[model samples]
Target chain A: MYRGLLWLCFLPSLLFGQRTDSLRIDFRPLLNGVALELEEEGGASAGAREVEVLRFYLSELQLLEGEEVVFAEEDHHHLIDAAQVASLQLPLTLPPGLRYDGLRFTLGVDSLTAASGVFGGDLDPTNGMYWTWRSGYINFKLEGTSPDCPARKQRFQFHVGGFQAPFNSERRVTLAIKPARSISIIIDLDSFFAATDLSQQYQVMSPGELSMKVADRLTRMFRVE
Target chain B: MRQGVILLVVVMMSGLAFTLSSPPGIAYPDHFPTTAYDFRAHPLDSAKVQLGRRLFYDEILSADGTISCASCHSPYNAFAHTDHDLSHGINDQIGTRNAPALFNLAWSTSFHHDGAHHSIELQPLAPISHPAEMGSSIGDIVRRLSEHAQYRQAFSESFGDSLVTGERVLKALAQFQLTLVSAGAKYDRVQAGKDTFSVQEQKGYQLFQTYCNDCHFEPLFTTGGFARNGLRVDTTLNDFGRMMITALPEDSLLFKIPSLRNLSYTHPYMHDGRFRKLRQVLKHYASRDVRPMPISANEQSDIVAFLLTLDDRDFVFNRNHGFPH
Candidate 1:
């Protein structure tokens, strides 16, 4: 009788056979034919020197099918740091047997998470991505040395983040891709440097119109391959 | 079968007794509003709070090992800087704003004079990395704490693991601060029907209800919001309070509304500690050209007498909040 009851409980699971799919995102930081490395000198426009640090938060990942939402990851927050090679590769699990045509994600943390009090994981205050004086997280952090920059060490640091109205820095990216098992996105650093003038605006360590402008520019830098 | 039933009954009764014997978590009066902090996420642990108390008094959090949280926030002053108008940090560097008192933090929705930090757990990061303050990175502190055998053992005991992370440090500090509830004042006693206010205190209480109750509400003694309070800009500091955070012109002079509790201990009041006495604060409020609430000198003294009733002598002298030694 006990064996029969056990079989009754297991029968539904065996019949349905639920399977999980893995989505791996390889974030390649590049400068037009040259992959970027931290603390190493990289060539830029007009004799600009090096790329020292590049980090950003990728959150609210969603898989879309036509106009319908197929899969969404809950509490998804990932911090990508250039110094750590392991951080570049992001692996996420998807619901079983779901076909997705496109991807929708925010390049930065949403306003809800920003307003919500201190949290653990990637959003933890100790991650160095958070601003100490101000409360918001540094959504996108890019620091480097450029000869064109007049600051000490010829360095430029852009820490962009703001969730409040009139200066919200969160940018959303939607990419249409063929239905596939996996996807790879390339973030072109060359385009970012080309559009920004390091000499004119070397540092953006606070949330404001400048940070929003840079965050808006970063929204267009992602491409699916 | 009888023996088995008896054994089960005894086991269940023992479990119920164990549950009843656990120490209480946080205790606040019935009239106070619900705490803003979500305790479900970070449950209270006595071990963690004890570890946090040690970390709060340790100078290892600073770059030069010269300062701790207690340096700026002394327990005698209700965790506020007593005489300093502006806070002094490591290397005797003067900070921009006065260090606010640290109590009833679980009820606070925002932190700092400018409302910069939304969460209490993240507030320590501001002072820890501030150039004028401790000037230490979380990574460096973690590395240092990991090397210390005492901290490692304490971390293991508190968290069931020895590895020190930034999240653990922040959460533990928050745990200790969350326990600093100041609800034992004489005003609280009057509210609970345990005692009665004197005639002078009663008159001051009525005046307070008429003039100050909207912003500095009873129970918590703060509405937990921001207000301008009509203080003109300081030419030297150029500190445009909440405008720096919101970037809105209307928010230019608005600052976080501080609680009225422990007024006697937390002197040199206001965001900049501009007024050393309650009389000056009352004078400023009475003379403000914009929305002035006029009051006579006698009325001002009455308000001061009432404010004194809000002081919780037991909280300030509580040895549990002091150094471990």
Candidate 2:
């Protein structure tokens, strides 16, 4: 009877230890209900617009159980490029039967990485995410053409980045999630257009108050549902 | 005596290992402070430095192959463009600011007058892609270098791979630049107790300590901080210095405080190269409305005489830093 009880106690732990599950985080770029495609005009309240580029760095990803941290990916820096289909999907393995209520992540590179000099992999200088004149990487890049903009080609380029105090453009996002094997995180471009006046403040190639404001708005655009 | 023989052999082997491990480059005086650069991230290799030296002198880095880094940063001029008020780039385009002298770069925390780049490795990208400079993209340079037989071999030898990447290119350039340690000047000799300063030089040194030491510190000759040295805005250029990078109002007109070392060879001083002579520089410092530190003409001449003691002829004429054959 004691042996049977011991087996009963050991079996659950053994099964749980062997049960490692993989979860997929799908980053879907959308304008209302429609999918966002580069160089394609999409409807907005102001007028029609075409997204030329949409790229950003997602870092310090963590899974949380209530207020307690359960799982965290150390040194995780991923560049999500809307132009590339493969970059939109990130696959992560989770511990067996570990209950996670929410996900938290930073929308930019850490200040430590910013000051450590040139890096390879996703943070490579050749990736074009890095600023040529300045040292910091562009945490988020969104370039599009809007009819409301008076600039040449009607282009609006927003390269947001800065790790220094006061002007830091990095944003933290905490998303509540339901228990699921896969999660689709929708990034609505419509909200981004609605939050700012594109005509007056179109080009933001450097770090400043403008970039921080834009980055703040970006933190609100992600929806876990 | 067998144990003694074994000990001698072991010692000889360890000495060989030590020599092989530590590449021959970048020796400074004990008085000099440790460098800001993390050498372990990109360790010094003689082969990489040699490759970088070749790349530095090669015009292939430019879009039209008409300009090179050496074009503006001439070796004889202590790696600074002389005579030109502004740096000249490809297609005869004039840059906005003067090209600063390049030496003792491993110790520098930031690059350019604006302090835009934090890393020495990332600094080259600015000139390479700037329309007013080399007018070439990193991708194009990589492609071009990949096609070249010599560069391909060199890249393979340096990086253990045939691929010529932008990271490797930048790292190699940084390695070559890190080898540029200018601590062999007469001032350095005096500091080392090998020589003595003249009476005029001693007086100037004291004056420099009193008036100039706040920004231009001892040993490294720079505090490596930005300062508003009271130069009026040029109506034509309208350069606001560090404010352009930080977008902060308080940082206005604060350009990088350049090192006093190699000033004898690197003439036409300051961010804009406004003064051709050191006397003019001294005069401006003495007369400027913004926090001016006044010094007499005699004192100014003495300071200039002492500045001449910082000339490192061995460094400027060092064949290693010159054009690779």
Ten residues in a row with the worst lDDT in model 2 chain B?
B18-27
Off by over 4 Å in 2: A1-19, A40-47, B1-25
Clashing pairs in 2: none
lDDT of 2 by residue, B1-325 (tens): 9999999999999999988878554678988997787776566888899988888999999999999899999889889998988998888999889999999998999999999998998899999999999999887898999999989999999999888888889888888888888999999999999999999999999999999999999898999999989999998899999999999999999999999989878888889998899999999999999777779999999998899899999999999889998
In model 1, where do residues sit more than 4 Å from their true spots?
A1-20, A39-46, A95-97, B1-18, B21-25
lDDT by residue (A17-108, candidate 2, tens digit) is 77787788999999656898677443233567878789999999999999888989898799999988999998999887889999999998
RMSD of each: 3.8, 5.1
Best by lDDT: 2
Isolated chain B TM-score per model: 0.94, 0.94
> For residues A35-80, could you state the per-residue lDDT of candidate 1 as single tens digits?
8766665435446457778889989988889978888878889898
Per-model C-alpha lDDT, please?
0.87, 0.89
Report the C-alpha lDDT of model 1 over B177-259, residue by residue, as the tens digit.
99999999999999889999989999999999999999998788788899989999888898999998887899998999999
